[model samples]
Target chain A: MGDHLARAEDFENKAEKKLSGWGLFGSKFEDAADLFDKSANSYKLAKSWDKAGSTYIKLANCNLKLESKHEAAQAYVDAAHCYKKTNINESVSCLDNAVNIFCEIGRLSMAARYLKEIAELYESEQNIEQAVVYYEKSADFYENEEVNTSANQCKQKVAQFSAQLEQYQRSIEIYEDIARQSLSNNLLKYGVKGHLLNAGICQLCKDDVIAITNALERYQDLDPTFSGTREYRLLADIAAAIDEEDVGKFTEVIKEFDSMTPLDSWKTTLLLRVKEKLKAKELEEDDLT
Target chain B: MAASDPNKLMAKADKQTRLSLTRWSADWKSATVLYEQAANGFRVAKDYENAKIAYEKASKGQEMLSSPWDAAKHMESAAALAKDLRHWQEVVDFYRRASELYMECGRPQPASDALAKGARALEDSMSEEAIQLYTDACTILEDDGREQMAFDLYRAATNVYIKLEKYTDAASFMLRLGLAADKCNATNSQCKAYLNAIVIYLYAHDFIQAEKCYNDCSQIDAFLRSDQNRCASKLLAAYRDGDVEEIKRIAQSSVISHLDHVIVKLARKLPTGDVSALKAEDEEEALDENDLT
Candidate 1:
């Protein structure tokens, strides 16, 4: 490792010397960039991530000096990969550099792609807030470029994490919006039910009766067939239980639901929360009566 | 010797038990799902009662799994069905329950939001009930440090009181609102609350209370003192002189007038210095005071 680092330093010196040599601007800068790239490769081979990152950054600088912004961005991206192994903050900074260069060069897709990568990196690190931010940024770019699928995919991920973090209202809004979009498009109509159900479920986390009623009415009218579906029925029954303050009734309805199909844990958790409240209300009602 | 092949029989029995257990679980799951579907079918058929019951059953499935949020969603669904049925009491109860669930889940804001819905569901039904729910909601929001939400709810309750011709009740709520607004340094709202209290008190024919609220409101709001001091003084003068006609004319022409025309007209029709209505109002106030004590 030491020998490889020494070799990297030697190559870096040669790159600097080349930059000061009497040659054409492109040739001299390219030579320097090539030598720096070799140094970065050597550092990487030696498993010296910090050294490799710095070398790649130097290579990027050489490319920038030559006014080859695209090449500079690629070098920055390479530097980010090296930085990922040793320093997360540096990795983020490198990725940011690449994004800035890519955006400046009108490579919006590239910028967006890097942003998604950053989001994924943050997700893997369990920095959910940062992950949401980067995913939103990526979604924004993709949306701007008319890449509907990519934008929606990133948005779906954001919605998923938002819900997991208990930002239920926001997740609900996002899912409903997606559902509406799907409902409007013939190709995507088939997927609307899933989104609508998700939104309806999230509505349970909110106390907006008007909104819930509006959503129900909207869903009922969306298709006559939808109203007959199990999802709609479950939501309707739950709403009834809430209104009646009947824990026993609520329990019976839910029990009936479980007997038909298994519930995912997330759905189960929210349902139980509603049930507990109903029981409390029942107790209060008993006292009132 | 008689228990020969005991291991083989035990193995067979164990296998039978495991198979039945799996089947039982599957049956439970399917039945639960069928109830969910049946609820939806009933909703589609506009059979609200059946839908409400079905949702309750679905929620029970979630409860068995100990899923709080999911269970809460079922109650929300039931509430929706009840709303469709125009059953205000049921809607309020469901929302109340949902709020508790949200609170239990460590989400106070959603808890308060659920109460807000409950309050709304009660709004167009029974005014007294609505007022109570709104008060409950405001208290929750206030305890949660959501001063703005609390203030909004109290204001809403006061409006409802006014609409119901419960002038004295409105006056009390407005006074409470003024105090809350003062604490938040919401000068405009504080002054407005005090002003509203003054008007409501006068409409209720509680002259002494009206004068007191007027003075208190003027002290807190310079704009009132600056713009409507003359109006207040003239009304007081008419009241003191026992000139019922003058009182009616001045109150009608006052800048701060635009109070409930019905109450003002009713006040005008009463005999001079009779004050029977005022006495009735005082008794109500006394009853409220006793309750507080």
Candidate 2:
């Protein structure tokens, strides 16, 4: 580690001298950038994350001075990775800088990928609201670049978090839109039923049985294969069960569905929310009578 | 008797026991000695099945000889073998039997320990039975004038009830724990138990019960002076006034947030829906109108 640190310092000093040295036709910036990159790598080898991150920033600055936007963005991304374990705020800011540079350089795909990375970082921090915002932006960029699969991935995250925030309408719309979009592509068609199931579950969270029934009908019409899927059957059964205020049948349907294809935690949380609503409804009716 | 092998020793012990049973005058003392020796030999050989049986027979013989402490020791050995075999029900039974034997010898602490251990062994497979054993153990400690020792047992039972989603039962157990804590003069534990009970009741949407719990806790001198008491009073007031924002504020307040995670979670879930709270308010208004008339 000590050896790496000394070598890193030597590289940094060389880079600084190159930056200040008179050169032919501004060739010194490129030399400085190369030396800074080496310094950053050596610092990374030493496990001095803070020093590595700052050296990468210097490399990014040199790349910017050399009018190389792509290299500058890559340098920022490298810096972000180095800072990720040490400082979340610094990492996020670096990624933001990288995304902006990628966008400015007409690299929309790279910009969208970095945005998704930012959303993931926020999600890991349990800042779901901020995560949703970045994911939405990433999804928009991915959609503009005609990358439907990656866009849908970000859209799913946005929908999941929106549902957790009790914004059922927003979640249902995203899921329904994604389901509609996926139905046309042969490779994406198989996942349409799952998307529809998530949309229906969001509708159920609103505690509106009629809306859920209508949405189920719309989904069945949108994809001919959807009504045949287990996701479809589970949603239809749950909608009926909740309509009749039958908690036992609701549980039984969920149990039966889980026995075949296990529900994920997101689905389980949404279902529990629906169940709690049903219980509240039951208690209200009991009180009225 | 000179046989060094476990199998041979067990065989000799069995033969001697059969001979004693058949005789008009039973040689109980020699039978007991042979059973203990065989049990130890089987234990050394790692033959738990034979060891457990030998220990049970030895325990029975010791009981007949009016040596209850020795009987308890053998029963404990049988219970250990049952645990090693993963026979959970048998483990519970043997330990319970050992606990009873220990109690007969006037050793309440060991009796309680035996019951608590049995409860822990059965907690996963048979939670209700575990709760029963835990409660019995707590009662033994309480009767033996060790109220502080019973605190964790009460807490364990409450946690099991909470896991089972029996919130009312959990709250009741928390109140009992509060009483136990109070008797032991453990002021912090008493306040926490009372506060947890109130939060649990509110989480279960039993505002009436929550209010009742708050009123009861406020009568305790230690609880009345505690920060938990103030939190509970504010929460109840928020519920009574049907103030959703106030409830949320109280849930996130420093006092409530610094409590147990389970209690914090329950506080955060304090019902925001107006249905139940509105209904309670309506009833209160009607009562006030009647009083005015």
Candidate 3:
């Protein structure tokens, strides 16, 4: 009878060996998880947390393959707890994996808890932002943790988050302060008059007359002796673009030219021509009057 | 036994003895005197043949002394004797010898004179031979790089070419004359040659090629003004003729800025009827009659 049973079970035994071989090489997590889980209970009964954790990791991987997000997260959490007694680092690493999986599954609150744990572990290892981030999440998970009072861990997480936020804000402030100092140095080296004139032109283009005036005022303050011919010309162009009678703009152009100590003869001639034309227009206006 | 008779007889005896002695010694001076005396005696007797023989002996004696001038004189006498004797070849030979000796004496002018006389003698009998002689003489001077002499030769040759109505060959020689002038850096001569070439082309009615030569001459600094005027006039005439070739020629020629300005001015004036005056002046010329009509 034993010989007959061995013959009948021969194919079944071959199939099991082939399945295990396929599990090792096939990269199919579902197949590998089924094979391991079938053997996991035995390992668990044998009080093998290591094997159980390994099987749970494989189960979590299989659940990931099936896109069963909650099950995969839970499995990774169980694996982390199992690995915790043996190696905290390995447990944190497993928790990291669980956090990532939970995040992918829209389990932000769970990911925040894992982040807090990882942050605490890293902070203890002197990682600041990571601890701050987990601390921030602990606050987010306050209602989710379902405790009567906030845990001390949660409270510590909040304080740390607050300190980290202040540190970050101070860092931003310091960056802005340094930027302002560099800008001032640049202005001292190469006068900001040209920059302000350019800013005035930009503001004029944007129809920001007040900003243009402010920039022009700043430009004059920086460069008191600046010739405003180009600015006056731009103003005239803007006035013309707006279909305004811009004799004042032209007058400003002439004033800018006249302000020079040794006026360009060509410019003087051109200004005389403009003045003559204005005189002719004024005479015609008087005749109309 | 009178003094005069004895003296005369002694003189006679001395003469006879000197004559015998001169015959024995074969002295050239005595021989010349004897020969002259014999020729005079023969002439007195009208013995023409002996007179000739006496002159021959004198010539032979002179030749024996190896004096070139004397030999040439003797040879000339021989030629005269041969001419009298109607020995034409001997006459030629003697004249040739005399000429050769004169040339050997570095007497080119005399040698040339003798050669010309010789050539004249041969001219009717062998005109081509006379020409060949002249050509040979010219080659000698040419080989010596005597340009003036060569130019004379070329002029002579050009005359010959013209006689033959070989104008192309004449022009070619004229071109050589120009080349010689160019080698001497005679810009005016080069310009003249170029002008002559233009004339040749124009006579051939090769207006385009004539214009090309004109332009080339114009580029020469020596002829610039004349060539410019010539070329511009030709261009204006060509423009009137509607000659596409002449127009193309002018277009390929140098651009005179002033002329371009004038043309532009004329173009501008045309619309206002201002160019009519210029047109009327052009019409007055006989060449523009066709256009006017």
Index of the highest-TM-score prediction: 2
lDDT of 2 by residue, B1-293 (tens): 35556567567656665644466654567777778877766764567798899889889889988999999988987887787778888888998999999999999998998888788667778889888999999999989999888776787777678778899998998999898898878998889899999989888888778889999889989999989998899888778777788888888777775555446656766673563556587788889988954
lDDT by residue (A5-110, candidate 1, tens digit) is 8998899899989988877747988999999999999899889899899989999998988889899999999999999988888999999999987765546689
**Ten-residue segment with the worst summed lDDT in candidate 3 chain A?**
A180-189
Q: Report residue B30 deviation for candidate 2 (angstroms).
A: 99
RMSD of 1: 25.5
TM-scores for every predicted model:
0.45, 0.49, 0.25
- For candidate 2, the clash count comes to 0
Descending-DockQ candidate ranking? 1, 2, 3
Model 1 residue runs over 4 Å out of place are A1-9, A20-23, A164-167, A184-187, A246-289, B1-293
lDDT of 3: 0.50
Which candidate's lDDT is highest? 2
Candidate 3, which segments miss by more than 4 Å at Cα? A1-289, B1-63, B73-95, B120-125, B143-146, B149-154, B157-293
